[model samples]
Target: MKKLIYSIAVITAVIQFYSCQKLDIAPISKFTEANYWTDIDKAKLMLNMGYNQMYSAGIMWRDEFLSDNMVHTYGTSDQNSIRRGEATASLNLFANEWKDAYGGIKTCLVFLANVDRVPGMPEATKNRMIDEIRFIRAYLYFRLVNYYGDVPFFTTEISLDDAYKIKRTPKNEILAFIHSELDDIMNRGNLPRAENLVAEEKGRITIGAACAFQARAYLYEGNYQKVKEYAGYLINDPSKYGAYQLFQYPAKKEESYFMLFTPENEYNNEVILDITYVPNLKYWTNMSQMAPISKNAEISADNPTQELVDCYLTMNGLPVKGTGKDPAYNENDPYVNRDPRLSATVVYDNYKWQNKNGSVDVIRTAAGTNTSDSYKGPVERQTKTGYYVHKYYDWTMTPNNQSGLNIIMFRFADVLLMYAEACNELGKITQQEWDTTIRPIRERAGFKVAAALDYPAAKSQGEIRDVIRNERRVELALEGLRWYDVKRWKIGQEVLNGTMHGFRFSGAGGDTDGGYVRVNQYKFNDNRDYLWSVPLTQMDLNQNLKPNNPGY
Candidate 1:
């Protein structure tokens, strides 16, 4: 993918407060007197650029892409090369995101600071823009503190020299700052409903997005009441403020979950805020880069682990409770009753396989299915994970194979889970809570909410909480929330660290060794691994900054 650049130049006889040679270039920037804040159109353009930055090298891919969404444990070569993957400090992106996140926050700040300069800009428009920027500013900083511990806070633009001298603040102080900014946005009535935007403006943030983010913020801090308050508003009147529909199974199972991320459905009611993907938009989505190779094409570097497959609940929406007595389980009843989300998420055995060409192609599901021993005609493209990611695969997107899909950053389903989580933590819910709160999601997923689990069951807080967590993991898999969910709940060891297994394949003149692969499931050997190690360079640049997490 080619690199995309975003900059706003302001001409001035600026003294060197920082060592930023990049900012010292000649006067092509529109921030000058004749163009910039000189008018409303200029201001609108500038503000739009800031938001557009998010879809570029900003928060869209780099920041959220490599996070806990998908676990990558490819060949030994890839694993050994990443220190962060092996739970060490030498990892590349981990050490760099500290600066990357700050760079984005800095850009957002500059846009906000300069908004007033545009002449003839209506007060209402100006205030709305400011509110949006403030929300972004808070969101970026929140991620910084969460991922990198403590780092510099940039409320204003700085030169390279002054930038190096900035010191990290205490974590609490950073949190307080985030709270102040969010509180202001919430009180200001700046955000509009998600449905208000036209087709061209669909991916922009909405009022529900801001409040949903606030609910997450409170969740991280263990502020149950705040989470409940914000999420409650969403649950009671989801149609009015939020947007998300329960999962609808497409005709072909592979297309079932893919609808969520397909470019055609990017602005669907389910998605609140998404990272837009325009094939002609001059930006690169890592989808093609991450997809597996086929008989006639090159495979993606990214591979899924067996652990991820096992995370899928049975057809009945319950964990596949294995029986230790039998080494070989019964295959006759494979699809009997399991978690509904499981089938929608994973392409496992006996299920239909719609070839990339939209034809009902017969693909092997039994053991010894590899054709590495044979030539590359039809069998070469079989998955390495034994199962494939069905969530983002588009049947209509075949021939050209250009993934013009928008990745959802926030959705109404997530809001529902957040509300359920808060309600569970709040002790108990009223009779209305079960019907109005949780049942909608159950009906969407084709699950029969047990009578005891439904409202009037008087279920305990812990029981309801468990149900909510399971629902989220099943429904949101591969959308990119799994790893973070495990870490925040401090269940990495239980969820990640273990021996991963898959079905053994054998047939069609194919023969292979072991044919069985064992991979690492998430688990914590050290407490410090819960939080990512702060980038090593960040600590060296500023002694005042806190050390990488606690253990590093």
Candidate 2:
């Protein structure tokens, strides 16, 4: 029995009704407090509500716009505004993200407070469920602190008066709390290892998830030692955390990387934590807005930028520009002799786009091309950039583009990359580390050349860091992680400033900078853009939320 909690179950109605009310108001439901916690299934239902709020596919997809990886051209979006350095404390993105994260935290608290009253639940099962809720709470807090430096922190639900008066906790304190909470949950030994989970419990929280999340937290904190120690748990002892390896297909090596996102590969060992969705039931329609215009998509909201395309190294592991360039890289035919992931991720001019009826069509995005996907100078429902995203095309999507593919939040490849980065930062990276982490990732990406797999000789620490960072970018592009990486690396000004470019169409008209399409000029205030402001609406409700982020 596939027992993953589909988010659209009847319990969702109850959550929606309660979620709309203010946080100060008590969660009202048809079932009174006395009867709601009487059954184990009801407890699970409440937990499912927390799962639904953990992550959103739409938010994840839009996050790329905040980074240099993508550009929004259709119209103004909150992410676009923020990227352009026009974000105010009143931006809906800030308010909505704050509200949604707290709502999720509240769901976890409610579940933890009432689950003990559930009758006939096995001690082991109840304890495991409690840890799961705790993990969700920690994850929510992690997001909150990452976005807003300091926020009002809480564990148990509070009264209306207490909620209003609660002051902002220091970001460091919140980070420490998250670390301690995750450590306690993992040390308790109630959660199962990733490999031990049965089909019915596929999407439940595991020890590996907690460990990976902790490592990511340390990564954001720039504590390389802690990142190494926590990420080492999975890298060194798979028997303890879980045996996670990059998903590969030896017969079809080139297609292995992209195939990992297909529906047939859901619940693969590579995925550490993912949002669960059921076909024809709980699904997302964001793909309809992202798919190619020629492929019957409703609208093209954003497009991959040339900056992201340039990050992919050649098959021989050489840069396309700067020092140690690829000698065979052709300027006119930039797609050839490049990393296989680039083709898998983006659809450029003359790209092959497969259709629902098993037919393939070539997408032409150059100016004056006879195709709906052609470049038309930043018009509505068209790609401003001369490219379309091909990484997440759900073959099993409905005619209306409703897709049920689970969105992976954490995966094994990311774990390896994190370990590699931490090792490099600590100056402890060796050939063995390279073989285990970067080498395998490149190999699975269909890179057969020894230069791409073997550890480079006579390279300084800085050079190795660049290689690792570039590898992480191409491997994890369009996964909503680029923005966090940019923020953590403090390269917002270096990357976000100046004009973003699209495909190079020689002799194209209108806003062409030496044949490159000028998508848009962006600005990044290094001091203020690094942290988002506390929403003005939030501050109005609670005067304690004073002293907003700088330059707001």
Candidate 3:
């Protein structure tokens, strides 16, 4: 796909700070003018700008917490932002989210409505472009309805004076609106795979991509039947739509899935849906923005918490408490033969982490510079959480340079786990179902079939649910999914809002030292810190918007 780079100043000005003062009257022929959508290229540019909104406020930062990638005890200084984010209150960011999404929604609607009016445009091609825009609009509204319980419904771009009168619709009504839009796209039957895009057309919307989101939208809304139906539609008939398939890793017993996120791999087959990144070319990916700064240019910022570490199950397919009887559970012998994912997801002490150039063990000893690979520059240190995130990042790729790894939107493993979770929830899992679906993942990861649960399990589901939950945590950790899983499942307080801890080498002393190094006990916090407050500036803008979660 040909990459288009817009001036950051102009894009931001148009979206967040679009006041009359900055809206200079350009010549009538300028692209920004109201009637400039007279050509095919101009229409395409407008649609591309709508896609860019997904990169800005939509998923990038929000996913950091929503996906359980990281948490902050004291990152922001705005207390009001924090207040509205209290799990029990309304989040201020939540309100801004509505605006951000609607901005893109209006832009898409306008472009789609006006694209056909462009002279010389073929009717067939124009119809395809309209279908793509509708898909994008449906996707934007899907994000809004999921985050905020209810939202204003807008199909066409509204004038400034008419915008304020928009009323909020109930979530169910909004969801129905979304479903209607998706059904229309399906009926239109013109969606294509990302790979089918000619050399000039990479990163445009595809049929498989639309279906994946359709599946995800239903999954998030607790509509399991729809989730299964849509996911099955994509997975069961691979020959018809060959864009997606489960990973097949022959070298390792556990199959590790990989996809394109860089320029070289941008059009690879495995990626179902991903936002593009261009390092020196366009704005680099969110990974570039978020990864820790390193001197060698091979690492980035971001430290995984001990809480996330504990979420992984033992290698034997049991919880830590359940593994107490096993030798690896001894207090004196932490980090022994543990779950394989633990090593894959985190760069813990003494693990041989290999990057493109070579391999290095991450040992953060306070003695000299407690970090791995001195080439990563001074600021690029290993994680403070006593572990490094390896998922979604190719460690071998020089971290300092712009990275190409595509941020994966969805994958087959997530679907399988979701299926097991839904079946477990609805009392639908049979022994045959477990063997056909869940067992393969467990066995591949070196785990035995999990033991059965008691009747209490039936009421709230069983160890099966916990197993699938942990699998997602370990498998999808740092991909930016963990935090949201906590909120939707109502486990955020018990998971994130707790004491954070990490290990120091055996010789260090004090709290900075991993207290009692040989013994891996954790430091602690309270459950009241559930949700994050929306930023304070947003709260000051909208009064009706409330705080998030509960106890701030």
Candidate 4:
């Protein structure tokens, strides 16, 4: 549980940029460049450090706050700025992404540069470690390119002189390198396939993880062919992608899909890669506190948006027909007959959560629904958006909930969803394709009704594309992929630019927009907000990263 931390130790006197901090400090005095990497265990420790830093801090929640999934009430300045069309460059390493990603990339470069020095290890073990570092490096750059369009790119360790002279590389070129790097790791490197890995190495990258990330990167580039190829690699063959299958409905569990997020089901086949944590160690995460229940006496930050709630399909696999539409939905019984995922991912009125003792803690958000109890919605410390996030809440660690629950970065269900999207984009989609992927997801979500489980017939690419996208939203809700999705789809202007809304706490509902609260107006300046600008201080340090991205 003891984490080893390191710095890249580059000798530089020039003004430091966020991406290029003094690469020479050993956070722990026990290890330094002179004595470190002298043994296999030491080298492995550094590699482990890379995994620790790879997606630390805000990377998990950035997708939700930066996109339309959550209505931010209290959080970081970056979250507020990104939502308000005013992301400044001062928040760099990534403006909206924060400083941790570049730090992670720096850690990888340091490890890749010195890992070979370690002796007494089998060549296979060393190569596997190197492969893992390569994957982390590629993944970090993947994040960089997604946020800052064309960032200064480098693979090897560089002096400040060379660093200052380096200009931003084209994003497509870096993306291509990310793809090739992942491909090399999966095809050429000796990383154990997911099915072959031991319990201790459960969260590490495997061929399936590499493939899933590659498909995701290609998806960003609009490379439908490559997306289809990589996703299909995982979808068409289970053995090839770690024998992944949906977590089936458990009779005793409150909800079938919720089981996947519980500690008892950690590292199930459905998960491709997860940012892991350990209890009573440096790895235990406080993310659970961000989405605390009303009575838990924790900070309430991430409130689920009404926009996201409506994204789920009705039980009939059709849009929730609002009043005046065919087969109009009744507002009084809004949660009934809805997509099963709605109850799984969100904590709404009357949500049944679990306790460590396996008892159900019914969450009553309505006013008078819990008049005698201290825990009720629309009260102080309650969610501003009328809903709370429950997707990754660790019930066992509640109250003093510093959870060891791993935050999933990529999973097989995402690959299937990606495959469905890619196939639809390529004009090769069919009802059978939906049945293969989307149907199973809903069915495993406890949707036994034929209307919700059956695939739709005879739809064009555009229609199915929406279906696939919405399916992705509901299936992966609150897992922090929504921002990237909106960016890649080029729909930020449409989704993030309106008046955000939620439920009426006063029981005054009459119309669709009635009794709702206006949270904030999310402004998206299509001219520049899509790709954030580099830090102004960084640009000032090195003029090479010139012309801050558009409106900045």
Candidate 5:
């Protein structure tokens, strides 16, 4: 079992500063503010609480709904509302995310304020813990600025009254602060490297994690130079930060890509950062909502779309559309002759699903075998897109589908992709860089053809840009990163304003768009949909929060 050592009870201190008549009567049994910060363990417990609030598996999975990657079967979902261009200032999704991010920030602030008060803690340990808390704070702030631009930003714990009166700060200022903090943490050298982490410290932050975040931060800022600089720190010299590589299963090389998510592969070298979960201790139910109904999934609310499915390249590393279109693509057998990752990530028509009893079951989504009804029937608890998410499903999970698999936040493959994008954007992508990044990724995904593994020497920069973006999409599909990519790339209107499709059910279909199931029609106002509206409830709580995002 992969244990998150920081899974301890949180110790809260209610400091009473003003006592009526100066009564010196100290409580004998209860822990007070004066007595709480005396032990190092208590400080660890406080930091543990911050770790618990850092990231959530459920929220990560739900974020996929914001992009074209996945769709919610229920029309009333918050994500669906946003997809339909009907988002309001009162949307609970906005308010809840805001609340959660701030809640995590507050935990980090509280830890930083009192951690020094703990007695007998080693200086090295203290500094490392401080860096860890700083990373958490930066991560939460990044989440805030990414969702709600110009959010109320603070470094220290504030009074409830002050929180109510605080005004929103410019998002650029917050981004600069995040970059600065991460830089300082990396330079300070307080955090351990990924390779140096003991079993007890498996899920803690490392220098590589900081570098990865810095690269991601620069990517969002569109500073390709800085992106290259930060990402190169890990790509150029892994020994200094941490050693990382694309994980490959020697015994079953064909299934290497799919095996990366199995519980047995948790904390692999490819994983720089992950949300740790131990069986029967800390697990998630999000898979229950996305898994196939035939696998005893509970809700089946989210499903993969044809837009994402079509993004996968054919076996010869050719697109299904445009000038680079694969000549051998068969509409009648769309899934065949495609990249191996297509089968690894998605359960499409005629997919071979593995069973617990060492059996293989063919999932025919269009014909409704080993799955819910076909897309034409439109049943509740069925995949409306005629596809199911196959990645990250723990087959060993109980019937309830509660899984202990750690959700990867930062992985080496993402670093490679970021580096490749930065190089391409800077017009400096050499074959050497291609070999270092994209080629290895495709090779590890079972690609053997020279066309799939070799760099495109003839393609223009714009065509190469498309290649890198598509590579990132198929490589990181259903991993909760597509929404950020769509936003940062500013392609929302181009991709989000069309009717999404499903499997080609030629005959028995009442609503078919050119023989394909019409899943849903979406709208995206590029003007307002880029930034979410500040929740109306938050605006009511603080008058300084007026003037929500443009279209709300």
Candidate 6:
């Protein structure tokens, strides 16, 4: 298979900043004039630029640190302020997010404006490209509206007259537009499935990706029917989705599912859509700094919170401390006989790190050891919560920490979880529904056959909902979905409040975090923290975006 490699020149975004006083009669550069869009190839190049412009590696990894999943150890990261409840209207992170999203929309609009000018291209390919632009535009709007509630909506490059005068469009309206856009494309677009794409087109938009994004948009709307409809299409009609089953190959039981994160498995059957990275072309993130067994070049960040650790169900499919309906759990050896995902997701006390040789490096998170390998002793940048994210570690990194690991943005496992959630919400979840969705995900995570993955005959809807939700958290841990899920479920007030705990470390007083060595108290201001403050600069540029997200 060919890798999606973008060695082409990056297109200058068509939407110039509002600060620019005047538009030049013509673009001084060759990239902007009629020469560029005269033919098929350059137009495709413009499309590729939109793809590159929209993606953010930070969203894939570091955003998880903002949620309860991981705490910022260094406190210098952008999300640190937001995590501490001190986020303001001028926070650059939120502002940049707004700019990038709208800028992406701008890029797509530019492409759509000129796509009709490209001549002598195959109709199928050209139509597919247009469909992709539609999907990308919808996706950007989805992110924008979700993050900041109301946003300036536009389908075309903003003219000077409309520029500063454009008012905020409600989030619901944006979502409705997204649904219609997705509907038209899915019904009429000649989009390929994951399996249908050539290696060079591996990262191109697909029907499955469109459906996945549409389903997610509806999930945010709390429209269970739309969620079930779209997700069920992908789940039931496997051929249409290129047969996206959970990647369950026969391998070592502990590590079979772990291979999903490896570069070797790029664009596999289960991958719905992934942001592709090509070495020396468009390199992706090097998580070696954050997820490594050592602090060689950089200190680790986003240390997995203990609360996240406890979310993984026991091997017998019970909580660490059993709930009202679930069986009692083993507190003494909570990590043992638990979900196989625990071993795959977190670097726990005494977790194994495979060396290039057949030897293994054991991770010991005990607090008081002087050993360099210990989480608290010799290392200055060890896991803050006594655990590190083991997923997406990119074991194949070069000595200097260069890696080309493509971030899997959407996978079939998420589709299954969505279906399960919608099913439960719609009061239609049954043993059969479990078999199709949640059961397979848990089973792939190393649940024993006929064990916890087995359908429960009599569980309340609330109990079933929690099981599905927790299943989502455990299965998608460290993938950056937990942050959105916490917000979407409106449980951030409950989850993000109080003292966040790390592993039980044997330590006395006099530390920066005080006697409670691993506790970091996070504040979630439920009254207004849900919707991020719109960037102050955006308002300064265009007051039409004013009355910023209430309480900004």
| Candidate 6, lDDT over the whole model | 0.73
Candidates' RMSD to native: 5.9, 2.1, 6.0, 4.6, 4.5, 3.6
Write model 3 residue lDDT over 59-143, tens digit each, in one string.
Answer: 6545654433453322331222332233323444544555567667766765755676788988777877888788788878777
Which candidate, 3 or 5, has the higher lDDT?
5
Name the runs in model 3 displaced over 4 angstroms: 2-35, 56-58, 66-69, 73-99, 239-243, 249-255, 258-270, 285-301, 322-326, 330-333, 358-362, 365-382, 394-401, 442-461, 504-552
Question: Which residue window of length 10 is worst by lDDT in model 2?
Answer: 23-32
Selected candidate, larger TM-score, 2 vs 6? 2
Q: Which pairs clash (backbone N, Cα, C closer than 3 Å) in model 6?
A: 2-199, 315-337, 315-338
* TM-score quality measure for candidate 2: 0.96
Q: Sorted by TM-score, highest first, which candidate order results?
A: 2, 5, 6, 4, 1, 3
Q: Clashing residue pairs in candidate 5, if any? A: none
lDDT of 5 by residue, 44-141 (tens): 77677667777868778878889999888754799999998989998989888887777667667767877878889999999999999999999988
Q: lDDT of each model, Cα atoms only? A: 0.55, 0.83, 0.54, 0.70, 0.82, 0.73
Which of the numbered candidates is closest to the native, going by highest TM-score?
2
lDDT accuracy of residue 298 in candidate 2? 86
Summarize candidate 4's per-residue lDDT along 1-552 as a digit string, tens digits. 222222222111101222334432111111234465677766666677678767753567766778788876654556767788766677643533424566566767777777777777888888888898899988878877877888877887666576566688999899889988988888875877788987667788788888888899899888999998988888776666667777654565336587888888888778888877665453444454455455453666667877888787776666764432326556665777787788777777776766668788777665456522222333346565667777777766535666767788888788888888887888858878878888888777766767666766656678678778988998888887888888889898899897787655565232335666566678998888788778775677678888778888
Better of 1 and 2 by TM-score: 2
lDDT of 6 by residue, 1-552 (tens): 123244344344333422242221101111234555778766776677667665656676756877888877654666777777878898888877876776667668767877777778788878998998888888878887878898888786666657667888888888889999999998895998777777678878899998898899899889999999999989888677557888865555456578888777878788888877765555655465566546343566557777888788767667774454235464444566677788778887767776534588877766665444355532366666677767876666665666667787889999999999999999958989999898778777877756587887688888889888888998998887888898889998888876776675546222434333454677888777778888887678777877888767
174-260: candidate 2 lDDT, tens digit per residue:
999999999999899998898898888887889999999999999999999999898889888888788888998555767889788
Query: Top model by lDDT, which number?
Result: 2
Q: Ranking by lDDT, best first?
A: 2, 5, 6, 4, 1, 3
List clash counts for every candidate, in order: 32, 0, 46, 4, 0, 3
Q: Estimate each model's TM-score.
A: 0.80, 0.96, 0.78, 0.89, 0.94, 0.92
Model 3 gets an lDDT of: 0.54
**lDDT, residue 430, model 2:** 90
